[model samples]
Target: MKTLVVYYSLEGNTKEAAEKIASSIGSDIMELVPVKDIPKKGLMKFIHGGSGATMGKGTELQPYTKDASSYDAIVIGTPVWAGKPCTALNQFLSDLSSTEKVIGAFAFAGGSADKCLSFLREKYPSIKYTVSLADRNSKKLAPENGSKLSAFIEELKSELISN
Candidate 1:
């Protein structure tokens, strides 16, 4: 199956996990870039980025050539903001709606992924698999949280083969 790993990263944590998943699954990758970059430091960053996600605001992304629907399966990754996915990732998911494609998601957060999972499940109920990671434990890609990502990739591969 042709799979794509799409993600948005404010810091490098989400990007690292995405890279590991892409490499493990041997899938193409796409990075979402917001037209206006979010601030990395200070309370304003939290107020703007966190509230944007909380309010379900979408950001303008740079021109991306790959279409998510073209892939047979898709894996989405993002850093959690205010217990939700980042604004840029939310925009990506908002623009992407495909019933024919198999979907999976992974969220990295400084705290927890409960709210992130809740949001994802509510928005994309068809997602077959999902995982959450803490940034402190996800410093390197190969084996984060007892190789959960690798395991997830293997499961996805199995599902693809079975289908």
Candidate 2:
């Protein structure tokens, strides 16, 4: 199956995880970039991002070449903000053109991602798999989270085979 990993990252944690997953599964990857991004540093980052996430706002994204409908499966990744997905990721999900393909997601958070993951599942009912990773604000992969990611990749592989 042709799988694509789509994600948006503000602090690189989600990017690192997305890269690892794409490399492990040998799938294509696409990064979602917002046209107008929130401040990356300072108190305003929290204020703006948290408010947007709390309101479930979706931002405008830069033009992307990948057509999600062409893939058999899609694995989305995002950083959890205010217990919800980041604005860029929300935009990507909202713009997704296909619903028949298998879907999966991964979330990065400072603490537990239970709420974010649940929110994703509820909003996107087609998602068949999910994994959460601790956002340590570093490029280095955590050992425990690595294992969880591996398990997620395996499940995705199995799902692809079944389909």
Candidate 3:
């Protein structure tokens, strides 16, 4: 089955996890980029990003070349921002046509991914698998987490095959 992994990352944590998930599942990957860039550091980033996520705002993104409809499944990865997915990913999900496709989600955070995962579940009822990682920063995942990612990929494969 063909699967795709799409994500938006600001601190590189989400990007690290997305890449690993894609590699494990042998899926195509897409990174969402916003037309307007968010500041990477300082209080402004925290204020803007947190407010945007808390308010469920959507940002304009650079045109994505890949059509999500072409994939049988899509795994979305994100880092928790003010307890929800970032603005870029929020826009992507809002604009996505996920009809007849299996959805999966993974979230990373310094403390918790509960809010992010919950938000995704509500938004996409098709999500069949989910993973949450805590305290992951802008670095590659550890070997143990890599094993867990491999297991997640296996579960996705199993679910798709059964369906």
Query: Which segments of candidate 3 are over 4 A away from where they belong?
Result: 99-102, 137-144
lDDT by residue (52-90, candidate 1, tens digit) is 988878899998769888898888888888887888987
Each candidate's number of clashing pairs is: 0, 0, 0
TM-score of 2: 0.92
Model 3: how far residue 153 lies from native, Å: 2.1
For model 1 the TM-score comes to 0.89
Q: What lDDT score is found at residue 145 in candidate 3?
A: 58
Question: What digit string (tens of lDDT, one per residue) describes model 3 on residues 1-163?
Answer: 7888999988887898888878866789999999986899898988988999999999999999689888888888887889988898888878887634747888878776877898788877888788877545424543345666667778887876775
- Please estimate how well model 2 matches the true structure, expressed as its whole-model Cα lDDT: 0.86
Question: Candidate 3, after superposition: displacement of residue 42 in Å?
Answer: 1.1
Each prediction's RMSD to truth: 2.6, 2.3, 2.6
Model 3: residue 138 alpha-carbon error in angstroms = 10
C-alpha lDDT of all candidate models, in order: 0.81, 0.86, 0.81
Better of 2 and 3 by TM-score: 2
Q: What TM-score would every model get versus the actual structure?
A: 0.89, 0.92, 0.88
- Candidate 1 residue runs with Cα over 4 Å from true position: 99-102, 137-146
